[model samples]
Target: MSKQSIVLEPVRCPDCNQTHIVKHGKSAEGKQRYRCRNSECSRHNFILNYSYRAYLPEVQQQISDMAINGSGIRDTARVLKISQTTVMETLKKKTLH
Candidate 1:
């Protein structure tokens, strides 16, 4: 069998929809990390393989809405039953744009 490398699509910011991201390195958990080039972006680094509902646009929007509604991080995480890290990450990206 021939070994092949899968070329993953470049991830765009859900907030700004920009492709100006760079591979910053890897996370401590060994996940592929990316950095948004937009200075206005709040998240300096993001892991591509984040666990939970990070892939869903609806979930991302909810994260923002909840935050705007004065929802605490722990509260959102608990209500959504997702990791607090995921909630924090989602909100971080939203404020960037």
Candidate 2:
């Protein structure tokens, strides 16, 4: 009997949930990056996993929520274990949008 090869699943876009993805290049941290081909997709490029906790969407959302709930920069930073600058910047950008 001939040996069978293992099949791997295709990468799906996190934004549009599409299968039209292509390898872009490696990130500065040597992590793999992928690009979405869907024209209607708002996402430019994304990594399946991020090395930094501050870069995670959930963390960013938490930052915004905490700020809305009257949390100070120092408090948020201490709780999130992220930089004060990151919390401030995220708040600024989030408020602007």
Candidate 3:
């Protein structure tokens, strides 16, 4: 009987969409995190899977849109099924950008 070997591909940077990545370290929850080698990339480190809904791009955009539509922070959180704190933090980051 012959044994077949599986080849694993390296991870890519989500921000720059580049393959120049290296393992940085594990996250607080022990999840694997990677560092982008692309100097021009804005993101320094990221993980493949995010545990929080606030980390999602669509959720971030919704937080901004809800604020623009005059929705309350708690209302947005309820509609989005996320915490009110997440809604506030998302909007705060949007303003800084």
Candidate 4:
């Protein structure tokens, strides 16, 4: 019997959708991290899958949507099961961009 290596598609830069990625390091939780070579990319470093739900893009968008719908910081935090400070920080970053 022989072992075979599985081939996977190249990792892409989520922001730029570019395939020029290099391994940066491992996260504290042991997930692999990647860096994009695209100079125009804003978010350079990222993990393909994050262990924490709060760092997800969908969750961040939900936080913004809830805020736009007149939801309080505590309310959004409670609903998302994330820290109140995280909700505020996400909103701040969204407003800045």
Q: Write the per-residue lDDT of candidate 2 for residues 1-97, one digit (tens) a residue.
A: 9999999999998879999999999999999999999999988799989998897878998999898788999999999999999998888877633
Cα lDDT tens digits, model 1, 17-87, are: 67898888876678788888888876566665565465566778788888888899999889988889988
Give the poorly placed runs of model 2, Cα more than 4 Å off: 1-4
lDDT of each: 0.77, 0.91, 0.85, 0.90
Candidate 4 structure quality by residue, lDDT tens digits, 1-97: 9999999998988789999999999999999999999999988899999888999878988998898899999999999999999998888889733
The alpha-carbon root-mean-square deviation between model 1 and the true structure, to one decimal in Å, is 5.5
**What's the distance in Å from true for residue 87, model 4?**
0.8
RMSD values for the candidates in order, in angstroms, are: 5.5, 2.1, 2.0, 1.9
Point out the higher-scoring one by lDDT: 1 or 3.
3
Using lDDT, rank the candidates from best to worst.
Answer: 2, 4, 3, 1
Per-residue lDDT of 87 in model 1: 89
Query: Per-prediction count of colliding residue pairs?
Result: 0, 0, 0, 0
Worst 10 residues of 4 by lDDT: 88-97
The parts of candidate 4 lying over 4 Å away from their true place are: 2-5
lDDT of 2 at 71: 93
**lDDT of the structure predicted as candidate 2:** 0.91
Q: Is candidate 1 or candidate 3 better by TM-score?
A: 3
RMSD of 3: 2.0
